[model samples]
Target: MKYLETYRLTNLPAKAYYIPDFISDAEEHFLLQKITNAPLSKWTVLSNRRLQAWPTQLLKGSVLPTTDALPTWLDDPLVQRMVSLDIWRQSPHDRANHCLINEYEPGQGIMPHEDGDVYHPVVATVSLQDGIVLDIYRKTEDGKREIVYRIYQEPKSLLITTEDMYTDYLHGIQDIDVDKSLYRDTVANWDFLSDDTKQRIELSGGDLKRKRARVSLTFRDVKKVRNLAAFLQMK
Candidate 1:
C-alpha cells in the first residue's frame, strides 16, 4: 500500500485512494457511449439501477465464466493504470478479471454493504456522467453501525478501495437527489480534490443537486473461474 501512499485517502480508512480526473474527458465520453449504446440484452435491470457484466455474469456459486476475457472496451489503459499502483499484487489473477458497469439514475442508490469474499478485496471504481457522495460505516460491538466517513466521487475520477476500507467497513450512497452537509471536514478526500470541484460544491451552498445520470465501472478479480466449454461438458 505504500506504493499508493501519494494518492491515499488518509482521513478515512487505512487503504483507499481517490484520483481526480484520472481519465481524460475524451475517455469518459467513450465509456459513457459504450454503456448507453450497448444492446438491451446486455443490461441486468435491478430495482434501483441497471448493470452490465463484461465476459458474463457470475454464476450463483460465485463462479465466473471462462468463455472470453473482458472486451477491449472494458480493459485497456484503465486496467494498465491500476496495475501500476500495485494494489492487485496479491490477487489470484494479479489483474482484474471481471468488471460490472452500473448505471444509476437520480435518487437511486444501493444499500450499505460489503463486497464479500467471492472476489479479491480490491475494488477499482471509475465514475462517469455525474457526482455522488459515498457514506462509510463501521459495525460496533453493540451491533450498531457508526458512520465513520464520507467520500464525494466526481465524474472522470477513480476511487480505489482496499485493505481496511474494503474489508472492515460498509459503503453506500444515499437515495436522495440532493446531498447536503458538505465541506472539507465531511469528505474524506477533500484535500485531494481539485479547487474548482470544491468551489462548485461550496457555491451550491453545500448542497449537491443531482442533475444528470451516473454510471460506475467497478473492476475486480474473481477468485474462481470455470471454462464455459468444460462446464457445459460436465452437464
Candidate 2:
C-alpha cells in the first residue's frame, strides 16, 4: 500500500485508500458500454440489485472455475492500474482473478456482511455513475452490530480496503434515497473527496440524494482455481 499512501484514509480502521477520479471519463464510459453490451443472461437479477461476474462465477462458492480469463474490457486500465500500485504483491495470485459487477438502484442496498474466505483479504472497488455512503460496523461480544465508520464513494473513484479494515469490519450500504450528514466528521475519506462533491453536499445541507443507479466493480484474487474443463471430462 506504499504507493497509495497519499490517498490513505487515516480516519479508518487501518489500511483503506480512496482515490478520486481514478479513471478518466472516457475509460468510465467504455466500461459502462461493455457492461451494457453484455448478454442479458450474464446479469443475475437479485431483489435489490443486479450482478455480473466476470470469467464466470465461482464453483461451489469457493473455487474459481478456470475456464477463461478476465475479458479485455474488464482487465485493461483498471486492473492494470492496480498492478502498478503493487497492491496485490502479497496475495496468492499476485493479481485479481475475478470481478463482481453490481448495479444498485436508488433506495436499494445490501445488508452488512463480511466478504468471507473465498478470496484474499484485499478488495478493490471502483464506483460508477453515482455516489453512495457505505456504513462500516463491528460486532460486539453480545453479537450485536454497531456502526463504526462511514465511507462516501463518489463516481469514478477507486477504493481499496485491506488489513484490519477488511478483516475486522463489516460493510454495507443503507437502503435509503439520500445520504445525510455527509461531512468531514462522518465520512472517513472526506478529505480525499473532490471539492465539487463536498460543495454539493454542503449546499444541500449535508444531504446528498441518490438520483441515479450506481455500478460497482469489485476486484479480488480468488485463492483457489480449479480446471472446469478437466472436471467436466472426468465426469
Candidate 3:
C-alpha cells in the first residue's frame, strides 16, 4: 500500500502510476510460455501487432459473452498482485475480468485510441520483454492530436492509468525501433524510473532501442457480461 505511492508519476496528469520490476523473470517466462502455447485460433493478428484476449473476444454488443473466468496462468500472482496494489478497488467486479495480450515487434505500434465506455475507467498494463515509450495526446480544436506526456515502460513493469487520464486523453506508441532524446525533462516517469534503467539509456546516447519481441498484458473489467451458452439455448 505505502510502496505504491513511491512509484506514482506525480508530474503526469490526473492518475498514472508506474512500477518497475513488478514481476520476476520467472513469472515473465511463465506468462510468455502460456501465451505462446495457446491455441492458434486464439490470436487475432493485425497488420502491426497480434493480440490474444482471455476467455474470449467480446460479442457484437461489446459485452463479454462467455462468462468464464480467466485461466489460472492469468489469475494467481499477476491479477492477485494487482488487487493488492489497490488499483481495482472500485472496479465493478473488484478485480480484472478481461485480459488482452498485445504483442508488438520492433517498429510496430497501435494507433492512438481510448479504451471507450464498455469497461471501467482503469487500465493495468504489464510490460514484458522490451521497453517502449507510450505517448499521451490531447485533441486540438484543429483536429490534430498534441503530445502531452511520454511514459517509458521498462520490461517487467506495471503501469496503471485511471480517472481523467484513462477517459480524457489518447495513448499510443510510435512505430519506431528506438525512442530517442529520452531526457529527464521529456519523459514523464523519468524521476520514478530505476537508476539502472536511466543509466542504460544514457549509455546509449539518450535513446532506448527496443530489443527482441515485446508483449503487454492489459487487464481490465468489462462492465457487461452474458452467458453465451444460455443465450444460444434460448435462441
lDDT of each: 0.87, 0.91, 0.89
What TM-score does each of the candidates earn? 0.94, 0.96, 0.95
Q: Pick the candidate with the highest lDDT.
A: 2
lDDT by residue (1-235, candidate 3, tens digit) is 3578788798987799998889999999999899999999999999999999997787764778755888889989899999998888898889998999999999999899999999888899999998889999999999999998999999899999999999889999888899889998999999878899999988998888888778999999999877887666756
lDDT of 3 at 130: 87
* Better by lDDT, candidate 3 or 1: 3
Stretches off by above 4 angstroms in model 2 are 229-235
Off by over 4 Å in 3: 229-235
What is the TM-score of candidate 1? 0.94
The digit string of per-residue lDDT tens for model 1 on 1-80 reads 23577888877767899988889999998988888899999999999888999878887658888776888887787888
